[model samples]
Target: MLLKKSLNIVMFLFILHFIIPTTTGYTHSTLEKTHPVDREKVTESPSTIELWFEDPVVLHADSITLLANNGSKIELNQTNVDAGDKTHIITSIPEELPSGKYKVNINVIALDGFVIQEKIGFEVIKEKATQKKEEKLKIVKYSPDDGEIVTGSPQKLNLWFNQPAEITAIGLFDNLQQPIFLSEPMVNTEDPNHIIVEIGEELSKGTYQVTWYAHPVGADINEPDILDVFYFAVDEFTPIQQLNKGEPTNPFWFKSAGLKQLGYWVVFIGISLLFGGTFLVSIIARQSDSKKWFRITSILLLVVIIGEAIILILQKQELENLSLRQFLSVKFVWIPILQIVLITFGLIYSKIRLFFFGVTLLLIPFITGHASYPRYGGYLTILVSALHLFAASIWIGGLFGLITLPKKEEMKEWLNDVIPKYSRWALISTTVLIATGIFMTYSYIPSFSTGSFVKSEWGKAILIKSVLTLMVIILGYLQRKTIKRLTSKAFSTIIRRSRVEMIYGLLILLFASLLVVSTPSAAEQGVYPISKQDQDRELNVNFSPLYPGLNVLTMEFGTKDIEKVEVTLSMPPNYNVTYNAFKVKDNVFKITGNLLHAAGTMAMQVKVIETNGEAEVFDYRIVIPGEMRLNE
Candidate 1:
């Protein structure tokens, strides 16, 4: 009883040690960096104030507001992220921003869902008429001789401005009747006025527009400013030939798949031989051999199954689409079930049947998953999953078998019998694992090159996993050879080798965990595709309820054209309604009203009528909980 309690405690500690939380601190590396935009002095009557960071930041445009010394709030026309680097650029100025001290209050949320608040103050000085007259207009020049057709897509579109223009906007679009939006453009630091728009992928032969617009420093427009546009064409273009094929962009993560496959096979085959041999040896010994060997094999198999189950569960969670149902539906599941059934029948009846049944059952999952896929034109997924399960069972289960076997001569005969039988199975399993791994690498990542593998995150991860797998294989070889000796002196050495292999197995597990979290390649985050969505219309409105009401409401909308809009706020039966409409912009409107004695869920109706007499109505409900914060 004491020994059992002690063993339980050790198992509990192992579980606790493996389950640490993975949250870490966020550092302000990009935000704190000094850039050219930051070094510019606070100019009197500056056209635009730009903030730059080292990395791209997720900004909440709605939350950002600029407050002046006066009561008036500055209106922002546009907020855009610079594609070249980590820069947030806001364009447009207040209609009549008077010369005074102004504060820019920026509340931004990053990509990782962390909120950051920043406030900066700058002085706006009154400019003399002479200073405005002295300001010179900047001219820009485009490379490729403006009309030259290159053989292949140019890496960059170079633009040279006569003078440094405060580049308000710049982007490229494919020349389709409808505009094909390009990825966000990044600014080139090599040349300030000269910007390089990077074309990361191959471009088809077509005419393209290289549009650029910039506002001169210290320029304020009473009317709308004119934007500059340029056109370029790519004809007879050829794509770059890929040098490194079948290499993962991030080697570390990519190689992990292979390493895991190798490790699983080694462990699976090792365990199978050990137990099968032991059972055979036990039966051949005197009937009074006590059948202690069979009990040991059962316990070892259980331990291995449990350990493998934990690893598989963790993996299933990490790989987005992987599921237990999917895994169980495959051939691997059948193999184990068969093995268990065969072992049960053998234990109850004949030892020879037990050996044959166990061997056949063990081979099913591996062969079905690995061999029957392409060559046999069977269910590929089932085959792969079966292979995975077989490898894990053998490797992990085999170690348990080695550790628990008794040192008696009867046990030696069992070991000798099990070891040779397993060797044949192990060799077959290892070969199948390697072949499948190679096939997967080629099929999944055609663009994988040697350079990409070394340089990219995925490649590096795959390399790490591969190295670990090799170590596991080496340890496996040693364990297999040592167990075959079956002498008293050899027992201790074999036990130690098995322990070392187990350590390597655990390390492989850790690498698998890391591989799952990282981006699959330099260009992509594992399986997640990167894309951008454009907003057609945006509206923001804030309203305070006049009555002792449960909820306060706000509504806002903005579009390209102006149209008539109607808003209604429903009040309680006893309360009177007063509505006022205020024009924020030509197309923007705000309605403010109060609801007296409003309770529960309040319904609000909004209607908009365009010039064509088409009306759109929207209904909204605001729920007020029992508790109310009067201060808010």
Candidate 2:
């Protein structure tokens, strides 16, 4: 049954890899903000344009272009960045122009040379015209969108604006301004914002324009009426017909995914054996063979820890863009350092030192892990996560020690005292492990639920770990049952079962290691949250990793379609940064930025503009956290 459980886990993982082998790779650093802003409306022509990106910019390889809707180009001429800040890019907009919309194209590179292209649109409208037509009332729909090429003759066209406005006249015309016949336009009394125009008959294939004049509600009557024009063309073919068809898909198996799985297994067994074997040796001094067994366990544990750390370090370096020097110097290096220290003291001096080194050895995974990161809980969760690691190590590591217990002629005499004491300690460690695991899970994944848990990689890992844990517990129960009815013939059978139980325990550790590498859904949701007093509207906002550095901000609206969002973080005395949040999914906007440079409280103001033109501002006192580390 224990072997069956391990086989089940392996099968599940095999199917998951073939079906869903983690499509999400490292996303390139995003361009955070622009001076005029993407799709912004400005009052007057600006002399300069600026851009802010999340990562350091590669200036020598970057380019920017400004183009008019009529195919004319506006020369930006020169580009520059602030000497002190590589994230800020600047350029000059030389000539001011008539009311029109322009597109700014940029090709940018990160320090590591990852390149991305973006096109931004900003409209230049006269101050008076802008006031008469509120920005939210701007046209959002069309008879056909601006650049669409339709195939079939269209008998009717529809347009929907963001809000209701007073309508005046409607005109239909060909490309040459030649008039076309159309029935009187219809506007639904219940939904006046949507306008529909019915063509009397289908016309020949050509370009056509729909023009209308209207005044927005709640505007001054003396203000000039607004004019809007939209165009669509009937072309030879639809784009869907021109698509390059491909054959059916095949299964994908990544070499990297396979290697990651391998790392997970090694680290799991390494921690368990290194700590468990130490605890086992401290209890047993009955036979001469016990000392030889302890020495063997020590050597094997040392090899596993060193090999595991190297594998994980290589994995991190390959997946990230950090320099080789930076990668080598990261917190992961502490693992091998601590391992060497523990082995030196524990082995040469005496076996008694193994007990101290054994407990401290578990700290390697705890120190560099995201679960115990300082931002989550000051010093509390870190301590709890460390305790959790230690408890699990004692429980599973001891199982490995049980496997090495004298299995031949000397086994019957040794098993009498060693089995019962180890069992009691294993029970105690198991209880602590479960309790701490639950506490830490609540601390980090507060949004935990069956639905949310299934959505995240972290949640999936936890689920698998729980399953393997159940298998180990069941095997422990059977081991106790075998011990209770032990006979002369059953000694070898009991040893075989205990060894299988050790394998099951190692499998639990495997899932736990995978969990360490995955990002929790809670963390992925956002970063440091703004203060409660700052919220003018009752919207739930949560940000992940509320530290002094880069973070992702997440906002959830109950039933509102957030039309626009503007966030400003004020690192008082000198720095003030603004960001435009973009929608990632349903009712959620994710904005990534560096909120501050030091540990202290900062002020953040979020202004949300809803689709109905309603706006609200929320003020928050952000507690900027510093990276907390465990003492060496």
Candidate 3:
């Protein structure tokens, strides 16, 4: 009878999974390559715009259009697919484009009839100085010189230009294209020609590349800019190659990274079911026949083993070219293997000591999680996280056990007996879960500002998990209230609510898996904005990064009849430049330039000219954030 009831429950869940719709699995052909790649700066404008796709695409006369930063469309010749490679599409520019920012808009139809529309932004920089060849700037020397491998992560990067120059912009990227933390550049006071920047944190073992732009101290506006690039490695060196940008069809699930996340979710659910089922069978439902429950949970343990194996394989794939011995030595590699070994043993010794065995298994994941690597209170954090996971297993696993209970005539008596016992355990588990969860949140997120917390992927995952947890809590409360009065009508309702609670409980685990893969410091750059109104006209300006580097200034006006907008920036101790704000859309203007060369209060003068001949000038003062670690 127990076997038949458990089989029925499994069949019900199987049917429910299919009843709900799954996302489309049809993969769309993506853009694989681009000429003058996105955001690349070229010394000379190319005669053609080339785009290569993963599959052939059908192009129309208006399939490709080039637009300047000011929103003016540039003329282009006919679009054609390369006969040599059907996947390659090319279009020509009729005339040379002036030095400015431009975007290539593609609206081609892929072979699968999916419309692929995207914009690739790039910049054209033509040197205008007629100075002699000897006067051209050059890099005299630099530490961690190109192709040099250091013993460990370098603390600082130094550059010596032939002449004194100020760094306008700098970027340091690892082989995986992830940016490393860097402080704002500083010119050595004693030696004006030398510049240095602090590497905020020690980098992991990987090859790195640095690109920087500098302007000669006394050079005119038209003088050619100085650009230098170099590559180095820490501990080891490897050839660099671009990574693919393929993504999954559904954006909401895993943000283009689905395979590993799917594995993690499966492992989490499997652990919860096995742990919770063991607890219920041993402690709460001992009088009932538990052989069928043990068999069902044993199968879940196998599933858990498979999930861990898959995760291990994926981790190996991420760190390529590792020998089996070297791979086994990594903590990330061995932890899953250890779990698999312990679970296999548990499956073998099931009827004797599986409940106590699960207690040991529940503590393994925290060894590689956030708690193990916190900045402060290391061991305490690991303990808190372990308790949190243990508590979650009790609540979530108990919920699963409740939903699978047979609906026979003795069900009411069974509920009366088991509900009170499980309720006490769940109540205590809830307290532990909430307390540890609060501590984990406070430890993981470094800042609560809009840029650091709200805009980060880690924060988003926490919020989604919190919402699912809240829903489960409400369902648990409903169950607690229903237990006081177990009417016949309320019996079916309670069962339905328990099943829904289990579903939400599983979703919380899914988000927990997401949080595991996310980086706490992956936050968006800051944006500062100001809004003002004079008479009937309103003006809003937004400045991004708020640091001394390449900055974008965006503005919005009250009316759409504006003819032109001009902005002049003035900073004391010698800095003044004017830039024209181009119309990006209706009543919105934007400009991108290397402004705010130094950290100080900057004065901005905005002059707006309307089509009706009315003119208005506004003055505003803004403070730029001091030297900061970009990654922070």
**Most lDDT-accurate candidate:** 3
Range of the 10 consecutive residues with the lowest summed lDDT in candidate 2: 623-632
**After superposition on all CA atoms, what RMSD does each candidate show versus the true structure?**
23.1, 14.7, 22.6
lDDT of each residue in 20-57, candidate 3, tens digit only: 44321122344656886877777788899998775566
Point out the higher-scoring one by TM-score: 2 or 3.
Answer: 2
Top-scoring candidate (TM-score): 2
List runs of model 3 lying over 4 Å from the truth.
Answer: 1-253, 286-289, 351-360, 405-413, 450-452, 487-489, 523-632
Residue-by-residue lDDT tens digits, candidate 1, 166-251 = 65666665534224444454456766666555665676675455556666545675524436544445663121122333632322
Model 3: how far is 586 from its true place, Å?
41
Choose 2 or 3, whichever is better by lDDT. Answer: 3
Q: What ranking of all candidate models by lDDT puts the best one first?
A: 3, 2, 1
Number of residue pairs clashing in candidate 3, backbone atoms closer than 3 angstroms, sequence gap of 3 or more or interchain: 0
**TM accuracy, model 2:** 0.51
